[model samples]
Target: MNILAIDTANNFLSLALHKDQSTHIICEDIGNKQSEFILPKINQLLTENDTKLQDLTSISYNAGPGGFTGLRIGLSVAMSLAYSLKIPLYPVNMFAMYHNALNTETNSIIALDAKLGQIYLAGFDNNGDYLIEPQLINPEQLSSVLSKHNLINDDDTIITGNGWTAYTEIFNQDISSQNIQYIESNYPSAATMINLVLSGKSQPCAAHEAELLYLRNKVALNLEEQKQSKQ
Candidate 1:
C-alpha cells in the first residue's frame, strides 16, 4: 500500500509517506506553520521517493479537536489534494490513533486540552473502536460522562493524548484502576494516521462532506455571537 498522511492537530506538524511496508517521514517543522509548510514537504517527500500524487493509494489527515488554525490548514490541504488527485480522503480520529498506539489491557481514554478549563475527549475500546462520541467538557463532566457510558471500574486502563497533561492529577485521584500507563512518546502524528489509512479502517470523507470535528462550536464563535446565542 502506498499512503500519504498529514497531521497538524497539535504542536507537532508531520507528514508521512508509506510504500510497501516501510515509512518515510518529512517533518521537524513547527505546527503553527502547517499551512505554509505542508505542501512543500509533500513535494519534497514525493520527489525524494520518486513518486507522484497519483501514486498514492490513500491519503489521510487528523480531523481535529485541536488548534483552530492548524486544523483548518491540515484539512484544507487534505481535501484539496484528495479531490485533485481523485483519491479518497480519510479522516482519522485523533483519539482512535491514540488508542491504537497504546498497549493497554483495557479501554483507552483519549483527551485533548480544549482550553477554557475544558477538554475535548473521546473513548475507545480495547479493539480501537469508538466507545463514546467526542465531546467538550471539564474534568468532572468527563468523569460523569464516562460513568454514564458504563466505562467505570476499568481495571486495566490507560489514558493518553494531550488531555492527559491537563487532567493527570484528577484521573490519578479519581479513576479507579490497577494499572494506568501514560505514554508521552505517543503524541499525535501523521505517521500514525497513515498506519490506520493503510489498514483500511479510517472513515472515508468526501471533499464537500469533510468537516473538522471541533468539540465545541462556541469556541469558534465570536464573543458577540456567543453572548447572543446564550440569550
Candidate 2:
C-alpha cells in the first residue's frame, strides 16, 4: 500500500512517501514557513518519485506537542488530503516517532521546544512504556521533573529532541548527566511515521476521527510573560 506522511510540527517540514516498498523522504529547514512549502514539497516528493496524489492509500501526520501554527497547518493539510482522497488517516505523536526512530535500549526522554522558556517532554521506559506523559516544563526544572517521575534517573538514560537542539547551552549546563546524549536526529520526519506504520504501532482511523493531541492550554503568551521568559 502506498502511503504519504507529513510532519510540520516544528520549523522544518518533513514529508515521506512510500511506494513499491521504497521510502522517499524530504526535509526542509524552513522555519515558520511550513504553510508556504508543505504543499509544494509534497508535490515535488510525489513528482520526483513518479507517484500521483491519488495513488496514496493512506496518510499520516505528526499530531503534536509542537508549534501551534505548524500543528494546525499540518493537521489541516493531512485531514483535507485524507478526506478528499478517501484514504485512512494516521495521527502520530511527535515524541513517539523519535522514540521509534532512535530505538534506544535505555530509558529515553523527549524534550521539544515549547517556547516562552518552556519545553514539552515525554518519558519512556526501556520497554517503550510511558513513564511520564507529555507535559510542559521549564528547562531549568528538568532535574526536578525527572526526579518526580523517576523515569530517567539511571546513569545511561538518553534524552533526544529539538528542545535540546534549540537550547543546547542551557541543557548542557542545567542537565548534569555525565553521558547525557542528544541524538543528531533532533527533528521529526514523516519517514519516522512510515516506520511506525510498518510496525503497526501508529494506528489508522477515518479523517473525521483524526484530532490534534495538545499537551497544554496556554498556546500563546502575553507580551510581559514573553519578555520575562527571555530573562
Candidate 2 collision pairs: none
| Segments in model 1 whose C-alpha atoms lie over 4 Å from true places | 176-185, 220-231
Give the 10-residue window scoring lowest on summed lDDT in candidate 2.
216-225
Q: Enumerate residue pairs that collide in model 1.
A: none
C-alpha local distance difference test of each model: 0.76, 0.84
Q: For candidate 1, which ten residues in a row score worst on lDDT?
A: 176-185
TM-score of 2: 0.84
Q: lDDT tens string, model 1, 1-231?
A: 688888887667788999878888876758477777788889999899989988987778888777778888889898898888878788987777777666465887777877666787888787777788788877767667777877676655556776768877876676636244565745755677877776666878777778877677765465566578779
Q: What is the TM-score of each candidate against the true structure?
A: 0.86, 0.84
Best model number under TM-score? 1
Expressed as tens digits, the lDDT of each residue in 1-231 for candidate 2 is 899999988778999999999999999899999999999999999999999999999999999877779999999999999999999998889888888878788888888887766788998877666887888888888877777866444665788887877778877786656455666774556788998888787889999999988777755444566778779
